[model samples]
Target: DQQVKQNSPSLSVQEGRISILNCDYTNSMFDYFLWYKKYPAEGPTFLISISSIKDKNEDGRFTVFLNKSAKHLSLHIVPSQPGDSAVYFCAASAFAGNTPLVFGKGTRLSVIA
Candidate 1:
């Protein structure tokens, strides 16, 4: 079974609006949660991340929220721009160093001008 899951296959939003992406995990051992954004013909780039110890983490226009008890997480982007259009993947890993990240299927977000 997949340890990470993104229920929404895609999302669409108009420019300057807010976009929210949801994710769920089955692994309780995961302490580090991350969100990656991928564009066509390119690799996924790290966006924002949250540690299990913290409920939320933010970087500029990106924010990540983690709910350890529910094994769920979500990513929020405010004032969404056209450049924000990409496939967002939810990932998780244990606290151990060098551990490989487990990724969700990903949700495609489209921003309309």
Candidate 2:
């Protein structure tokens, strides 16, 4: 069974609109959650992250919300731009210096201009 899951295969939004992506996890030990955006032929770039201790974290146009009790997390992008189009992956890991992240299947987001 997959520890992390992204049920939506894809999402589309018009430019300047908001885009929301959801993720769920089965592992309760996971304390660190991260979101990464990947483009074709490139490595995933780190977007935003949240610790289990915090309910929400935001940076500029990106925000990550974590609900520990529900084992769920969501990523929000405000004023979505065309450049924001990419595959988003949600990853989780137990708090450790070098623990590997367990990743969910990516959700493709297309931002139309």
Candidate 3:
């Protein structure tokens, strides 16, 4: 079974709108979570991240929120643009350093103009 789950396989939002992507994890050991955005035929790139200790982290138009009690997290993008369309993957790491990350099946996001 997957340790992490994106639940939604795809999402669509109009330009200048807000897009909310959700993720849930089954493993309690996970202490860190990161959101990765991938384009066609390209590798996933880090977008935003949050630690178990932090409930929310924001970077410009992107914000990541962690709900430890629910083992859930969400990525919010404000004013979603066409360029923001891509596959988003949620990843979790248990210990610090180079530990292997558990990844959820990515969710493809389409930002329509």
Candidate 4:
């Protein structure tokens, strides 16, 4: 079974609009969650994260909401720009600091100028 899944492999939106990406996880042991963004050919870079203790976390134009009861999470990006076009991956780790993470394949966001 896919412990982590991003059902949609790609998403498209116009510049200055809102973009939403959805993710789901089956493992209840996952206590920490993270979102990473990647440009072509580069490793994913950390974007935002939330511990299972919090329901939501926001960072400027990016926001992540976690619903532990439902095993669901989503990322929202506002004022999307061409520069924001990239692959986004959702990861889960049970522990903090150097623990390996389980990753969803990724969702490619295309922001048209």
Query: Model 1, residue 58: what's the lDDT?
Result: 87
lDDT of 1 by residue, 1-113 (tens): 99999999999999999999999999888988889999999999989888888998989999888888899999999989999999999999986424799999999999999
What 10-residue stretch in candidate 4 is worst by lDDT?
Answer: 91-100
lDDT of 2: 0.95
Query: What lDDT does candidate 3 reach at residue 86?
Result: 100
Error of 1 at 29 (Å): 0.3
Best-fitting candidate, measured by lDDT? 2
lDDT score at residue 4, model 2, on the 0-100 scale:
98
lDDT of 2 by residue, 1-113 (tens): 99999999999999999999999999888999999999999999999988888999999999999988899999999989999999999999996414799999999999999
How far off is residue 4 in model 4, in Å? 0.6
lDDT minimum window of 10 residues, candidate 3: 93-102
For candidate 4, lDDT tens digit of each residue in 1-113?
A: 78899999999999999999999999888989999999988989999998999999999999999999999999999989899999999999885525689999999999999
TM-score of each: 0.96, 0.97, 0.97, 0.95
Q: What is the lDDT of residue 112 in candidate 3?
A: 98
Q: Which residue pairs in candidate 4 collide?
A: none
| Model 3 regions lying over 4 Å from their true place | none
Ten residues in sequence with the least summed lDDT for candidate 2: 91-100
* Residue pairs with clashing backbones, model 2: none
Query: Which scores greater on lDDT, model 2 or model 4?
Result: 2
CA displacement after TM-score superposition, residue 107 of candidate 1 (Å): 0.2
